[model samples]
Target: MTTDILTVSCPSKRGIVATISSYLASQGCSISDSSQFDDVETGTFFMRVSFISEEGKPLSEIAEGFTRIGAEWNMNFEFHDSTTRMKVILMVSRFGHCLNDILYRWKIGMLPIDIVGVVSNHFNYQHLVLSHNLPFHHIKVTKDNKAEAEAELMAIIERTQAELIVLARYMQVLSDELCRRMPGRVINIHHSFLPGFKGAKPYHQAHKRGVKLIGATAHYVTAELDEGPIIDQETIAVTHAQSADDYVSIGRDVESRTLARAIHAHIHHRVFVNGDRTIVFPASPDSYAADRVG
Candidate 1:
């Protein structure tokens, strides 16, 4: 039984679900799990459907057949074979907690992504990235050579034909051009404190203010620094007793988990970019199944 997923987004209209369901059934596909949203304010409809092809129809056939429905609804749609893993490129700076966590998940088949390569501005994680038999690119970025560095980075992206770029604690701010070019294709993770805790040792500042909650945000990278459409977020309760160091430690765990969840939602096609926000659908029943228990 081959499983396939179909994602559709378009202007809201009547009979969209019925039409889609009918078409899938006409093709001998049985829907296993489905999610849809109708935005009343925006008048946009989003849907994701996971189905099993009882007749074992090829994806191309199913997609080609759906073109009629797509055309009728003026929908932007995609059909994905559930077994196909999305290719991803990871960018990281000196921080390795998120990088390390992603690597472990990828290694254990928990992430289910093909990590084409790792790009870093420093040599800190060169050895670790290589240990996994993955190519490591060291493209140092300086104020004077920022453009050149990004060019080199784009070259890698094109060469690998990577589908997504994950900035797992990458420190440098990407240029507006790069951000515009990638749009929702690039994801970044950072501490959730912004505006309140501006610069340098944010945890320490939070400690001084006696903040009760610490969290991380994973969002699609945009031109306006960290102000992109958020995909996932998590927070941990903190008390007055915990020190700044404890905040950092707990925040690291939150960041890693939040980033991983964001990546999972993205690779599985569960996220839809709405206006300034996002429409994230729930995961399928088997989405969390890893190949092995480690």
Candidate 2:
């Protein structure tokens, strides 16, 4: 038996489930697990179906055969081979917490993706990444070398066939061109609650403001820093008694966990961009682990 994962989204209509399940039954496919949602206000239907294809059916064949049904339902969808891992390329500079977290998750099979390479403007983490046998590139960037460095980044992404790019506290500002070209394929982690103390030393700023809570945000990387559609955010309450360093300590954990969750949602195709905001559907841990593409 061949296991396949299918996803669909379209205008809500009566009998969408019946049509889908009956079509699967007619094709001799057995449903293993399924989930669906109907947005009453928007009249949108969304579904994720995991099924086993009878012997002799492969993912490509199943995908090819679903065209008619997809067309009939006016669906926007994808058919994925559940076992294939998504290829990822990570970029970071100075900060190691997010990068370390992702690396550990990947090593432990918690994040089902292949980290193709690590790119850094500094050499701080070269030995740490090399210990895992993954390639690390050090292409220093300055005002004069920005173009050349980005060219190197693009070259690595192309050669590695990287489908998703993560900025794990990568401090450099990306050029306008790369942001447009990559669109929704990039993810970035910000250390503080965005739209507030934005630039550098966010923790210090928040602490100085005497704010009662600290937070982190994980969002898509667009041309504007910290302005992309947010995917996930988490907060940890604080008090005036805590210093900046204390905030930093607590903030690190929030940053890593928030980024991980956002990446998980992105990889699973559970997030949808709605203008400057995002719509993230609820997902269980098992459903979360199996389908994530990021």
Candidate 3:
């Protein structure tokens, strides 16, 4: 049996589920797990269906068969084979908390992705990434050569055929041009909770404000600074007894957790962009189950 995941987004209407199930059944598929959402406020519908092809139909054939249903319902849909892993490029700067966490999860099969390459403006993590047998690109970026550096980075992305870019605490602000080109393909992890404390040293800002809660946000990269469609967010309670360094320690854990969860949804095709927000469905059964490594 071959498992394939189907994702759909369209205007809200009746019989969407019936149409999808009926179509999949016609393709000799049986739904093993399914999730759907009807956003009344946005007047849109989103769904994720995990099904097994009992007759062993190829992904292309199954997808081709859904065209008519897709057209009739004006739906945006994609069929992904469970065995296919998404190619990704990870970018990071000084902070290695998020990068290290992602590496561990990827190695353990909790996060399923092919990390094709790691790009960094600094050479801090060259040995770390190289130890994992992954290609590491050190393309230093400075104010004087920002454009040239980005060109080099683009070349690496193209050469690697990377489908997604994960900015795991990369401090450099991406130019508007790159953000426009990639649109939904780029994901960034911000230390702050977002729309609250943005920009450099967000932990310090939060500490100064004397807030009781500190959080992190993982969102799609946009031209605006730290303002994008939020995919996942996490917060931790803080007290005046904790120092600024303590806040930093707590923030690091949340940042790693939030970013990992967002990427999990994205790579699994369980996330959809909805205007200024996102619709992230629950993970399929056994998604977080890991294959232990020695």
Among these predicted structures, which one has the highest lDDT?
1
Clash-forming residue pairs, model 2: 267-292, 267-293, 267-294, 268-292
> lDDT by residue for model 3 over 1-294, one digit each (tens)?
656789999999999999999988988889989999999998999999999889888889989989988999999999888778899999999999999999999988888899999999889999999999999999888899999999999999899999899999999999999999898889999898846677768888888999999998899999997788999999899999998999999999999999999899899887899998898898886344322245
* TM-score of every candidate relative to the true structure: 0.97, 0.90, 0.96
User: Whole-model lDDT, candidate 2?
Assistant: 0.85
* lDDT for 124 (candidate 1): 99
Comparing candidate 1 with candidate 3, which one achieves the higher TM-score?
1
Question: How accurate locally, in lDDT, is each candidate?
Answer: 0.91, 0.85, 0.90
Which ranges of candidate 3 are over 4 A from the true structure?
289-294
Return the lDDT, model 3, position 249.
Answer: 95
**Ranking of predictions according to lDDT:** 1, 3, 2
lDDT of 1 by residue, 1-294 (tens): 766889999999999999999999999999988999999999999999988889988889999999988999999999998788889999999889999999999887889999999999999999999999999999999999999999999999999999999999999999999888888999999776445875567778888999998888899999987889999998889999999999999989999999999999999899999988999997786465423355
- Cα error, residue 99 of model 2, in Å, equals 0.7
